[model samples]
Target: MEFEVQVRGRTARRWIMFGMIALGAMFLAIGLVLTGVTASFLSDAKRARGSVVALEWRDDDHGASGKTLEHDTPVAYPVVEFTSADGMPRKFRSSAGSNPPSYQKGDLVEVLYRADSPEDAQVNGFASLWLLPLIFGGVGLGLSGAGTAVAMVRRWRS
Candidate 1:
C-alpha cells in the first residue's frame, strides 16, 4: 500500500504561514538596524575603555496594553558610557533590567570600553548584544511569511 499526504484540509495552516512571513519580514528589518548600531558601537569601543554610567528611568508613556502605564518609568539601570572613535560620549543601557541595581546619579560602573571610541563598550559584563539575532529573526519571519502566503494561496485555489 502507498500513502500520500494531501494539502486538502481547510486548516489553520494559512494563519501559521501568514505569521511566519510576517515574522521573517520583522526580523529582517531588525537585523539591518542592529547591524548598523553594532558597527557604530564597535568602532567606538576600539578607541576607549567603556565608562560606567547611571541610567535613571525617564517618564512613562502609554503602553500598548495600558495595563500599567506607569510601568514605563526608567528605574535605574547600569549603563556603559564611552567616547566613540569620533570623540563622542555614548551611553548604552545595561542588560540588567530583570532586576536593575539600585542607581545613584553618579554610580560607579565597570566597563570595558574601546580606546578609539567610548560609545563601544561593555558594562558590568553586559554588552549591547542580541541585536543581530533579533534582526535575522525578523528577516527569517518575513521570508517565512511570504512563503506561507504563497502556500496558502495555492491551497485556497485548489
Candidate 2:
C-alpha cells in the first residue's frame, strides 16, 4: 500500500511537470507565430506621419468591482489623423492605452499601414510592434524553465 501511494505521487508530479512544460511550449509557439506576422506586416507596411487629434478614455477596472474603495483609473488611447499615400484622409484610435496618456493633442507620431487598408493603421514604435510577442515568449520561457528545473531536482533526488 505504501509503495502504491508513492508511485501515485510520483505519477502526479510527473503529470504536473509535463502539463506546465506543454502549456509553456504552446505559448512559445503562439509568440513565434505572432512575431512572424508582425515582421511580415512591417515589411509590407507603408509609413505616414500622423498627429493626435483626440484621446478616447475608458475605465480600466482591472476586473475589480466598482463597489470597492479602490477607484478605477481611466486609460487614454490616442486618436490619430493623417493622410494616406493615396492622398485620402484616415483616422484610427490606437490599440494601446496608458494611465497618464502617452500622447497629447497635436503630438506627431509615425504611422504604419498597408496602402490597400489605410484605416487599419498602427503607431510605428517598438512597444506597438514587439511588446506582445516579447511578453508571451518571456512567460513561456519562465514557465518551461521552472518545469525543467523541477524535473531535474526530482531526478537528482532519486
Top TM-score hit: 2
Question: Which 10-residue window of candidate 2 scores lowest in summed lDDT?
Answer: 61-70
List residue ranges in candidate 2 displaced over 4 A. Answer: 61-71
Steric clash pairs (candidate 2): none
lDDT of 1 by residue, 1-158 (tens): 12222343334566666666777767767777776766665555443455455564544356677555744654455566765556666888765442354445465655546564444456533323554455485567658768776887877988
On residues 19-132, what C-alpha lDDT tens digit does candidate 2 reach at each position?
889888888888898899899999999999999999999875655444523567788989999999999999999988888988999999999999889989999877778889
Off by over 4 Å in 1: 1-16, 43-45, 50-55, 58-62, 65-74, 79-98, 102-127, 131-158
Worst 10 residues of 1 by lDDT: 1-10
